[model samples]
Target: MAEENKQIAEQLIEAVGGLENIESVAHCATRLRIMVTDKEKIDQGKVEELDKVKGAFYNAGQFQVIFGTGTVNKIHTEIIGLGAPESSSSEQKKDAAQKGNKIQRLLRTFGDIFVPIIPVLVATGLFMGLRGLLTQEEILAIFGMTPADISENFLLYTQVLTDTAFAFLPALIAWSAFRVFGGSPVIGIVLGLMLVNPALPNAYAVGSGDADPLYILGFIPVIGYQGSVLPAFIAGFLGAKLEKWLRERIPEALDLILTPFLTLLIMITAALFVLGPIFSIVETGIMAAMNVVLELPFGLSGLIIGGLHQVIVITGVHHIFNLFEIQLLADDGFNPFNALITAGIAAQGGAALAVAVKTKSKKLKALAFPSSISAFLGITEPAIFGVNLRYIKPFVMGLAGGAAGGFFAALFNLQGNGMAVTVIPGMLLYIYDFLPFVLYILTNVIALSVAFVLTWMFGFNDKMLDEVNQ
Candidate 1:
């Protein structure tokens, strides 16, 4: 496998205009992200044709070659070993496209910083959903008991698994943000730990009015940052920049000792006294606005967001929505945005499956089948980029399907206990209630049937299938 990856890496190097044209390289869960100096120097078509390369797209100024999951990491490692200077970070690559827009850059930075941390949250979400199932009155009644009758230790174990991540989310986000911003992650982590120090009142209690906020300057309210995203992000960025600024002026002789010590003292103070209070207000307002949007009339919000969600995904701005979903989950114990997003994803899968069934060309069928399955499994890029978008009609049908699913999700007030992961794998997120789980299945089926029927009627033709093969 190593040799095969290196060989593919060699082909990819020459195909992307070699080491000279390449500026930097990185990888995500499924694609090899490359930033090149001159777009015209590389042969995109040839890169697409390379063995094991599923598809290629130029989005937001980055040339992304989809190599699937496990395969991408190996190929990316080989490419880096071949002397292509690695990109400073994935956000840099994401930012190369929208550098002119401040909001875009900030959103990309958040996306890059949080992507690594999402897995833990996803696992916790799944754990929570499963815990709800096992402890449900209905599920337990079948076994002659209720949640109250469950063993104390087993319940405690489940609580630890499901609640620990959210309780210390600030630390995870801070550590990741600092790494992205070029600071010592360990220092960042320590700073994060300080935000949730035992001496301070818990953030949830403060929010719930169970505990009073600490006062600074006799007016500003300082609260511990637990289960908060925006404040941690801001604190991490400032902390990283401060560390860098101090390192430059401090003499090398006593740098190591002084730098870390001073950085922590300064950042910890600012995060507690200044940044925490101000940014916490800002985060609170943002979360309030999201809730209001979700409450919009006749489910118009979900209809529109669901219809355009995949469009945002194509532009790579969809990561910003992850923050919104996380906030919703943290604040309300449910995420309606996740349900809407799942509709969009299932629609993409539906469109791809339609093409796979209808296409006459063996190659197109081969491409569409697995890509559709992948989309159903919560990875939609393959279906979206490699199949549906290649046929514009199917993609349009998908939007219609998505809008339908979203409308119903909103009408039913459908929600999940999690963010990230959708469809097949997403069942873990909705296992909390039998009704919600049934609705989840129906949501996907509605999307699937609508997109499939629409595409079969209008999306493809034998001529397009021939072109696809050629």
Candidate 2:
């Protein structure tokens, strides 16, 4: 075990370029993510060759090394120095002058929810989306021939897929929290599962509204921590402290059973009552802050949204932004106050499309173009992560183009006020359908065209296209 661990530790250190080479260490889902000075300095092939590595994939400015299982605790120890981010100004500056580790934190939470079950979600999402289409037209009923019980096969299967992801979210988070605290996440996962069970009210879909999900913990007013990313975050923070203490004091034989029990009691108690509410309120504040920013200025708003929209995608937290989009539309169908979105789609999508064409790396090109098309079709994730953000030049150019386009869109009062990106099909979805439609379509075309031209002009120097293609 020591030999294997030594090898794993060595591989990790090497992958990140000696222990000193690592600026920061973090993990999410299948990847042991790192922040480094230069990605070129690392040997990609060696990282891939490691027995535990699933693969390494780079996109949207982040490089990731995949580890299938037994990853959380191992990588967790490497970061946070087994417990605590340094309080010194230098350490904070190091963390700050860099990417703020927000990506790392967000990725960890997302991993808790969907990473473990991505294949299932996609397969099931496809099935459910198709089945919904089929059933709405009574296609499925034709085969079964029953009004009351037409065909739940699609619904059943889709629910199975969704339920697994949702129900397991807490447990997954627990594991992550454990790892974050410098302990075995498996036990944390066990306690998280306890909260996620169906028997627990306010466990699933309980975070949004006016109710506290936590009913009680044997009569204490513990809040619900189920289906929540932040709760686990708080729990993990405390759990780590508890784990370090137990590790020193407990005897080896009884430690395994006894330590976990104490961690559970203490962590759960703190998470359910004290920390849960605080995290919940903080999450609400973040959403409020982003919405406030959108109202600031067309140019600034566009720049912020355009630049970070892809970051939102890479972390899979774009859904949080999306909730705001929905609310904005609902509040004012014909509202001009909202930051113009159609232009954002066009600018980002255009930038992605441009990179798709310019890159000689056929694999990246293929992913980029089709993904851009998908973004055009209202799925910005693939385009933002796979294409635009990969090349800094294109991403920045697109943001500039997006800001210009969005400003023009706002000036024109071009409002696609109904559905978001996919509403491309129905221009009437815009309140002032004619002006906004013309402006949106025109700007999207122009910005994207310019984005493509810019990427070809600038990125080719760094792309190493000639060497790679040769």
Candidate 3:
């Protein structure tokens, strides 16, 4: 197996125009992310056809070859062993900035800032779902206890599990943004904490009219930035930039003390008095616009977003949705977008499964089956690029399936207790409510069935496979 992996690694290096052409290489979850000096020299078709390679695509100025999860780690190790330059984070970011267009780079930055924070949110979401399920009136009735019978301490414990992340979400975002933008993370955390300081009016309370905003200069309104994304992100960016600039100018002896002191003083004043109020309004407007779309008559919103979701994924800019979804969860405490997108994800898996079942070639079947499973498990790139997009029609069928399921999702007013997980594993999010859980399952079934049936009937055949193989 080691020798075979080494051979595949050698082939990959050669396929990408030899080791000299590779500027740096890295892997993330499922793909071998390579930065090459010359795109024209690399043979994309050969890269996709290499052993254990599911598919390959160029996005954000990187040639990413999907090898699935465990397989990718092995292949990456083999590549590095063969003397390809392993990318440092700084080198990768530099390459991304130089290679990608403005929109791609912006989206990548958002991804970098949010990806590390997702696991915390996912765990909190699961905690929320579990707590919701356990505390339902029906569940309580089974135990011959009412809501009043439950211990207040236990409920408080559940709240700790579910609410802490969101309550201090600004801190997490700022910390992540600081790291991404090259600032002292500890300083970022301090600055973020100042935004949500107990001294200020709570943001949610101020919005709900339960608490009035404190007046700065008797004109400007100020409030804590709990559960906020944009303001925190912007503040983190500005703070990081300011910190870097100050570090360059400040004397080495005073750098540690003076830089942070000046940064916090200037940024906190700017954040509370200027950036906070301005961006908070902007963020609210964006949230309101999203709500309007989600509330569109007859599930049209779902149909549009669901159908186009996977197409967006193909561009590698789908990370942009992280902001929208996170905002939905923070502002509304429920995420309808999660329900809408799951249908799109499920359809990809279904379409891939159809191709796997129908393909005659052993090689194609081998790629399609695991790719389908990977999609069902909440990652879709393998199924998408490896099988569905390669066929063209399967991808379209999947889109149709997504539209159908999304229609049902919106029509039924389906909402998830959290975000992040999707498809089969996403079942955890719906378990909080029995009816919603059933409807969520039904939505996925409709999506999977529509894509599978459509692909089986018209999207694929052995003839097309034979032609491609030839």
Top lDDT hit: 3
Cα-lDDT of candidate 1: 0.85
- Once fitted onto the true fold, the runs of candidate 1 whose alpha carbons sit more than 4 angstroms away are 1-15, 18-20, 23-26, 49-53, 71-104, 465-470
Summarize candidate 2's per-residue lDDT along 75-148 as a digit string, tens digits: 44544453322233223324433453667555434443333333432333334334444444355466765445
lDDT of 1 by residue, 266-333 (tens): 99888888898888889989888878878888978778867889988887778877788777777757
Ranking by TM-score: 3, 1, 2
lDDT of 3 by residue, 392-431 (tens): 9999999999999999999998999788899888999988
- Best by the TM-score measure: 3
lDDT of 3 at 312: 95
Candidate lDDT values, in order: 0.85, 0.54, 0.91
lDDT at position 412, candidate 1: 88
431: Cα error in model 1, Å? 0.8
Which model is ahead, 1 or 3, in terms of lDDT?
3
Write down the worst ten-residue block by lDDT for model 1: 91-100
